[model samples]
Target chain A: MLVIEDLHVKVGDREVLKGLNLEIKSGETFILFGPNGSGKTSLLMTLMGFSGYKVVKGKIIFKGKDITNLPVYERARMGIGMSFQRPPTIHGLKTRDLVQMCAKYAQNKEIDVLNLAKKVNFLDFLDRDINSGFSGGEIKRSELLQLMAQQPDLLLFDEPESGVDLENMALIGKIVKNLLRGNGESPRPDVPMKELKKIRQVSGLIITHTGYILDYVNADRGQVLMNGQLCCEGRPRDILEHISKFGYKECVRCLNK
Target chain B: MSEQIKIDRFKLEGMEVEQDLQQFVSKYKEELEMAGIVVNELERSGTYLHLNQNPLQCKSHQSGLEILDIKDALSKYDGLPDYYWKAVDKNKDEYTKLAASKVHGGYFIRVSKNVKIKDPVQSCLFIKDENVGQSVHNIVVVEEGAEVHIITGCATSHKVKSALHLGISEFFLKKGAKLTFTMVHNWGEQVEVRPRTVGILEQDAVFQSNYILLKPVKIVQSFPVVYLNGSGAVARFNSILVATPGSYINSGNKIVLNAPNTRGEIISRAITTGGEIIAPGVIEANNVPAKGHLECKGLILNDGVIHAIPELKGTRSGVELSHEAAVGKIAQEEIEYLMARGLDEDEATSTIVRGFMNVDIMGLPLKLKQAIDKIIAETEKDMF
Candidate 1:
C-alpha cells in the first residue's frame, strides 16, 4: 500500500533518515522497533508530508501515486492518516466537530459520531475543545476515534502505548487491532477466518519502543532501526525478543556488520 | 482620546421617527435584527425603542417588572434619586458630559424584589438620520433576591453613514440578586461611538456582562467598570471585538473585589484585518480570600494592529490575582493540526478563527447567536 525508496529526510540542518527504503504490501502490518532519536517519528512525519521535515531525496508512492511533494491536506485526502504523538490543543474547535469533519468524505454509509465515540469512551468529551487538557490515554482514544471516522486505506501510528495506563492500554490495543484488521466494532462472527483474511485491505505502519503492541496486533513483519538505518528483519515476535534480551546495542553492531 | 471629535458638527435634534410604530418596525427590521433586536415583542418581557432623541416605544408585558422612558421614570421617582447617575460619574469625560447635559432618551428597567423574569428585556438605540448626534442614559436595578436579563442593541440605519452615539449606562444589583446584561453593536462605517458604563454588586450577588461589536465604524471607545462591594459577590465580563479597514476600536473592562470571598474574571478576544484595535483588561482584589483573573487574546490577520494589555492587582495578604495576555497571528501548528484532518488551508484557518471567537459560553438566545455567526462568516471573508 505504501512504498519509500532512498528516502533521505532532513529536519533543520541535520539529516534524520539517510537512504532508507521500505515497503508494505496490501493488508500487511509492519512493526518498526527503534531506539530514541533513531528517526522513527521523522519517517512517519515525512510520509504524512509535514512541513520542516524536508525530503532531500525520496519518492513516496501511495496507492500508485507519487505523493512525495504533495501538500499535507492532499495527502490526507488521498487516504493517508496519521495519529499524532503530541497533538496541538485547538481552542474553540470541538472534538465532535472535528470527528464530523473527518467523516465528511465517507463513501456510502452515514457515520454515527455518538456511537463511534462510545467505543472509545469519549462521549463526555465530545463538546470540549480538541485535545485541550486531555490525559495521555484520552489523547490516544481521541486519535483512534478520528482515525475510525476517516477510514483511511493506510494508517500510521507513533507509539500507541507511550503514556497509557494498564487498563486503558488493553482498551486502546483492542481498538487499534480492530482498525488495522479492517473490522469496525464487530468482526462478523459468521464469516470464516480464511474469507475475512482475504477481504482485509487496510495497511498499518506502527512505531514502537517497548513492543507492547505485539500482544494485540498480529504483525506479519518487523525491523530494527539504528543510527538512521534499518538492519534486522525477521518475525515480529523474534525481533521483540532479541531487542528485549540484548537491547539496541546489539542492533548497532548488526548495522555496522 | 488622541483624535478629538467636533461635537458641534452633528445636529442634536430633529431626527425623530415620524412613521407609525408598526411601519417603522417593518422598514428597519433587517438593520435592527443585525444588532440582536427582534421587532416582534411576543417573546420579550419588555421593550424600549429609541430613535435618535425620540422614545418610540416603552412597555412591559410581564408582572413585577417596570419599563419606562428615562424622562417618565425621572418624573415618577423624583429624578430616580437613588439610581440616576449613581454608579457612573457624569463628569468623567466629554461624552458623559454630553449625555448628562441633554439626555435624548433611554430605558429605565426595574425588577421587583424576589421576582424572577424569564424572558429578556430588550432595548434598541437606533440612529436613522445622517450627521445626527444621539445621547442616552440607561438605568437598571435588580431588587434583593431578584433575577433578570437585559439585552441592549445599538445600531445606525443603513442610509445613515455619519453619526455620533454617546450612551451612559448604570446598573445596581441588591443582595442575592442575579443579572446578565448583553450588548451588541452594529454601526455604520462612518459612525463614532462612545459609551460610559458601571455596575455595583451587593452581598451574594452575581453579575455577568457580554459585549459584542463586529462592524466597522470611524472610532469607538469604552471602558466599563464593576465593583463587588459585599462578601460572596461575583462578576464576569466577556467581550468579542473585530475591526475592519479604516476602523478604530478601543475597549476594555475592569473589576474590583472589595469584600472577602468575592471573585472576578475578565476575558476578551479581538481580531483586526486592516484596522486598529486596543484591548485592555484589569482585575483587582483588595480583601482577604478574594480572587481575580484577567485574560486578553488578539489575532492580527493581515496588515493591521492589535494591542492587548492585561493587568491584575492584589492588595491583601490572602488575595489571589493573575493575568494572561497574547497578541499575534494564528499559530502555524494549530493550522496544520486541522489540515491533517482532511480540511484545506482556508477551511482550517476559518475554523480556527471561529473557535477563537467562540460565543458558546455566553448562553445567548438562538436568534442572537445566529446573527453573530453570520457576522463572523462575513468578517472571515475580509480576513482572507
Candidate 2:
C-alpha cells in the first residue's frame, strides 16, 4: 500500500505538484488521468524519488513507512517499480541483459538471461543495446519486461500506452496486465503455481490520457489530476466516457465549484 | 657506476632503429610484455601488443584483420615527413618516411582510404635498463576515407631507477576519414614518460582517442593536440587515468577549430589513491559554427590528490563551447543503487565506473572494443 498526504513537490524552481493527495491499496488499481504537464509525471517521479523533485511539504508513505528522502533505486528495491514514459536509451546494455539484471535483483539469484529474452519475445534482439535503436513498440515491450521482472508490490506506469502501435499494443497490454496481477515480483524457481494466476496481484497507479488502456486493464478507480491536484475520483468506465465526450472541461467545472 | 644516471639522445642519424632501440627494448621486454592478456582472436585488426597472461585473456592486440604487414606499412612513408610535400630532412640517405628520423623518437604509419581495418596495431614499450633513456618519434598519416584502430600498451616490472619515453606522433586525417587510437600504460613505479601527439584533420574527418591506465607511474606528461583545419571535422578525447601510490599523470589536450562547423570533445577521468593528477585541457573554437566541449570526471577512490582543471576559450561568438569538471568520491546514491541490486560496494563502484565509461565504443575494431570493455571490467576488480 502507498499514500501521498497533501504533498507539495517542486521540480527545481517550479512548484509542479502543489498540495496533492492520493492513495492506492493492495489488490486494487488506481488510474490518474491528466492532460500533458498536469503534474502526473512529476507526482510519479516524486513518489519514485527522482533527484530533482524536492518535497517542500507533505510525506510519501510506501508499505507503512515514510520514504520522502529515498533515492529512486532504493524505492525500487522496496517493491516499487516504475515504467518511464520515455525510457532513456542505454547504448551498450542489451535490453535482454537489463531485464535479466532487474530480475536477478528481484530474485536475489541468477535469472537465466536467455529465458528473459524469450519471455519478452526479444530473443533475436538479445545482443542489441537497451532501448537503443529500438522501435517505440519494442521499447514499450521492454519496459513491460522490466516491470514483470521487478514484480513490485506497487507498479506505477507513466503513459504506458502512449507510443506503442497496434502491432505491439495488445502484447504490451497483456504483459502489463500480467505484471499487475502477478505476486512476489518474480516467479518462484520451484513453485510454478504462483505464476498461474489469471489476474495480476500487483497494486498499480497508472497515469494516462487516451484511456485506451481501459479496454485491457481493469481500473478500480479513476482520478482527474489537473494543474497539480487531484480534482475528482470515480469509477474507471464512467470517468473515461465523460472525458471522451467533453474533455477536461467537466473537471474544470468541478474545480470551479 | 653504483649510481643511477639517466641519458637521453634526441635526434640520432639515419641509423637502424631495430638495432639502435635494442637496449631500450631489452630492458623492459619482460615487464612490458606482461601487460597483454589474450582477448578474442577473432578481432585482431588493430595496432596492438598483448602480453601472454593466463586466467584473463592476453590483451587482444589483433582483431583478426588482414593488415599490410609492418614491412608494407613502413614502405609507404619512404622518406621524410610530408608537408604540402616540401621536405627539409637532415639527410637524403633516408629511404622513406619510415626511414626518416628528424626527432629523438619517431614512427611512421599509413592507413589507406576506405579500408576498414579489423584489429588494432599493438605497441609494447618496456624499459628494464636503468641508466639508458629511449627517445622515439612517430608519424602516422591516415589517407582520405581510410580507417584504422591503434592500441599502445606499456609494461615494466624491473625496479630500474630512470628510463624515459619521448614519443611524438603526427596524424593526418584526409578528407572524410576516421582514426581510433587507444593506449594502455602500466609503467614501473619510478619511470618518466613524456609523449607529445598532434593530429591534423581535413574536411569532414573524425578522430577518437582513448587513453586509459591503472598503474602508479612516476611522471607521465602528454600534450595531445588536434587541429581542425577543415570543415565539419570532429574529434573526441577520452582518458581514464588511475594513479596508485607515488605517481603523476599530467595530461592535457588542445583543440583549435580553424574551419567552419568543426567540433571537439575532451574528457579526462581519473581514479587517484595517492600522488597527484593534473588534467588541464583547453578547446579553442575560433571559427563560426564550430563547437567544442570539455568534460572531466575524477574519482578519489581513497585518499591522495587530483586537480581536474578544464578551461575553454571560445573567441568566435558563433562557436559553442562548454566545460564541466567534477571531482568527488562515489555518490552514495549510486552506490546504494548497485547495492540494492545485490552487488558489493566495490562491485557497485566498479559497475558505476564502468557504466560511466561504457559510452559506445562501437566504431573501433572488435578486439579493441572488446579489450576496452574487458579492461574496464578488470578495473572494477578489487586491488589491495
In order of listing, the candidates' clash counts read: 0, 57
Cα lDDT tens digits, model 1, B136-183, are 999999999999989899999899899999999999999999999999
Model 1: DockQ vs. true structure: 0.81
* TM-scores for every candidate against the unseen true structure: 0.97, 0.65
RMSD of 1: 1.5
The per-residue C-alpha lDDT of model 1 at residue B379 equals: 78
Best by TM-score: 1
List lDDT for all candidates, in order. 0.90, 0.68
Residue by residue across A53-159, what tens digits does model 1's lDDT show? 99999799999999999988988888888899999998889999999998875442368899999999999999999999999999999999999888877889999
lDDT of 2: 0.68
